[model samples]
Target chain A: MSVKYIPVQWNNNKWKYNAVMLASVFAYLWIFIFVTPDLMSNEGRINGAVHNARAFGSCAFLMLSVILCIGPLARLDNRFLPLLYNRRHFGVMTAFVAITHASYIINWYFAFSPSNKYEALLFSNTSYGQLSGFPFEVFGIFALFCLVILAATSHDFWLKFLTPRIWKRIHYLIYAAYISVVAHVGLGILQDQQNHTFTVIFILAAIVVATLHVMAALHEKKHGDPLAAESGDWVKVCETTDMQEGYAKIAQLTAKERVAIFLHEGKLSAISNACAHQNGPLGEGKIIRCLVTCPWHGFQYDVTNGSSPAPFTEKVPTYNLKVEGNTILVDRHANEPGTYVEPVPLNIQGAAA
Target chain B: MDQAQAIFFAFQIWCSIGALIALFFLTIGIDRIDEDAQGAYVFRLLLIPAILLIWPLVLWRWFILETERDAWPNRHRPPRHAHFWVAIALAVFIPVIILVSLSVRQTWPVDFEPQKLSLLEERKS
Candidate 1:
């Protein structure tokens, strides 16, 4: 009900970092385009330009995919949440570079056509005229359109105007954009009948990433049912104050909500045992940097917001905790907002909950 | 069919197949995943790249399979504010300029040797 993790000052540094990343990418593209010589013969130069644009496009797409992956990884593994914090920067920058590359291809294909009037437009439409009119280009154009939509909406103001849910739906266009770029590479480059190596590489890379996700998903399905994973209702195993130093204990709240409570640095923290993004149980993950990091996907929620340090993470609910006398007791009735559940402490010595 | 026609037909068919296969995998894969995993975070990561490779498939999946839970046409509401339009315009403008400049910079010069010019003319024709 209450928005727990909403901060007073949306981090200005985060926006600045995004701006710097985008500016740097633009600078790099500017240098590459201006400094490069046009010494290659007409066909040769055009081919070279397309090739360079594609290489840049591929890299941009890869960066965008990684940025998109960060939030899931953070929710899956809280240690990785930091990566999600800067994901928008990466997404916007990748969009910028991709736009540059898309424009280059459009120009290289259209600008220098010597055909007059109708003939030129007709020629451009022919298969041999514009990089063989590879359907990939059409898809590429469509994807670029999506990227434009996404990049435009990336700003916080637009996000607020659009509402997180609506803005989020539109942002999903990036997926369509990714597929378009892939088709652009696959058909325009791989299906070229002349170049197979790069196509194969792209296919392989895609296969691996897709496979990793599938395998992870399968693993979660097989072993990740929160309700089935534990015995009994999630019970408060210890009093809030009874948790000693360097300690971790499992609490089963309901069959669906299992948690691990940890006492570290004289503070008590609790978190969902299951990863928020992929359902990887936190109970099995390694704790690093005072956060429980999911082994699968690597999402990290702050032990305090169930909010990830990362910007785009899904929030996991944290429970209400109180210290009563020497005996540890947890009320199953009241759950509070913004309580970050810490991972189970590895050892029991010198700890307090 | 001639060689060019053959290539076009082949490329078209291949893309169509690729699009279909991508849709197939995405549907089955997405259906199998749970609520948390299917959330925007993982969906963006796993599906975005696949969509990049095969957009029609992704669009079909997004509109038909994914958004179907709500409804098709009304799944995405148009933005209400003038600022939303402004944002869209700015996005389009930035890319349009870059595209135009790149086109201008790469424009071919008219002056050239007559003999070699004929070769280009022949190629064009």
Candidate 2:
């Protein structure tokens, strides 16, 4: 949304989001480090690097769990869309916390090793052949690597450079990272600890993330299927009276491409449902002042041309539309991005008042 | 050397090279290729870790940009379906791994006891 790239396009919303997130992280760390040990009996008390590592490690795991949940939650409900806005910052912070956790472990456990600390971390455990001690550090290392890469590339510059498709492909490593983390905890900590707290928490978090995703997929499959073509080269989207003012009715074409048919000022315009930024659901966004605003990041496009107003160079494919009686039909073929299509004027008497 | 050590040694070398390439790329090569990167400093710093890991790809892209100046490949390709399968695999793998780990957990010989000899017995012997 910027003509020139700055470090972050900070807004009031971003500041509030980040402040809340940071405060929560600090509070969690404080509770885990200071409050938890006192709650335990004297014989069971934990402190030093062990306590610190657990504090940050568990915090990072929880943060990652929350991060994974945001996508599905946003898909399921619009109330969760605010969480999706500053997710990159959340991810980067999680990486830093994870790094701190790793640092505490390395400094404490591998401090006396003859070789390099990192080398010792990898080489000290050679029980890969055995299932019980399968060098769970490898899984931790893989997860850390993925997190680092993801955190590093979370910038918009990388998104533009790598292209959205490739960037998205790279970010899919988050799933692998999450799975690796689950294995790392399961094999390393759960195997050693008699306490089932972490085990239960990890199991529940994984299940919740997986279940939310499956639910979201099911929801999309049920509601997002393309509309069948009713006539030649056009698909009936809805009745003219059914179109909401300043809102879009999402129509899925035969090619599985979604078209957001917007109603504004007794006129209808159809554009690609995908937003140029992060592919946010443009159909879910509300139209204001003849411009449709993407709900996720607030990237806006002029409804008629499917192009962001000058100074911002984002665009989505536009589709031709027609009205027969009260039925709204959109052309099967989409025009090139930024191509302007004449808005089909509707009779005010026939449209919803 | 063992396989783990060997792999680590190779990785160390790769990272060492990547670090150098990342340094060069962030400082100079990025601006040369991408107009948007010309004056931006903070984003370049953020790119360090990823560039270090994928320096070869960066170099390849830089080389391509050096020749054509604007041939950004794969910018408009449709999203791939490979990640879906990977996700499905991970979903299945997570529970299976936890179960496998639990089932194969090693048991320690907790009943083993150490025998002690009395000082008097030792002296008599």
Q: What is the lDDT of residue A328 in candidate 2?
A: 89
TM-score (C-alpha) between model 1 and the true structure:
0.46
lDDT tens digits, residue span B1-125, model 1: 24445555564686676566656544554444223233323333333343444455334544544443533112112221222332343344333433332232322257854367788889999
At residue B14, give the lDDT of candidate 1.
63
lDDT of 2: 0.79
**What is candidate 1's lDDT per residue for A156-208, written digit by digit as tens?**
33332233445555766664565556555555544333333444555555444
Clash count per candidate: 43, 0
Q: Write the per-residue lDDT of candidate 2 for residues B51-72, one digit (tens) a residue.
A: 7787776777678677875422
- CAPRI band for model 1: incorrect
lDDT of 1 at A169: 56
List lDDT for all candidates, in order. 0.49, 0.79
Residue pairs of candidate 2 with colliding backbone atoms: none
TM-score of chain A of 1: 0.54
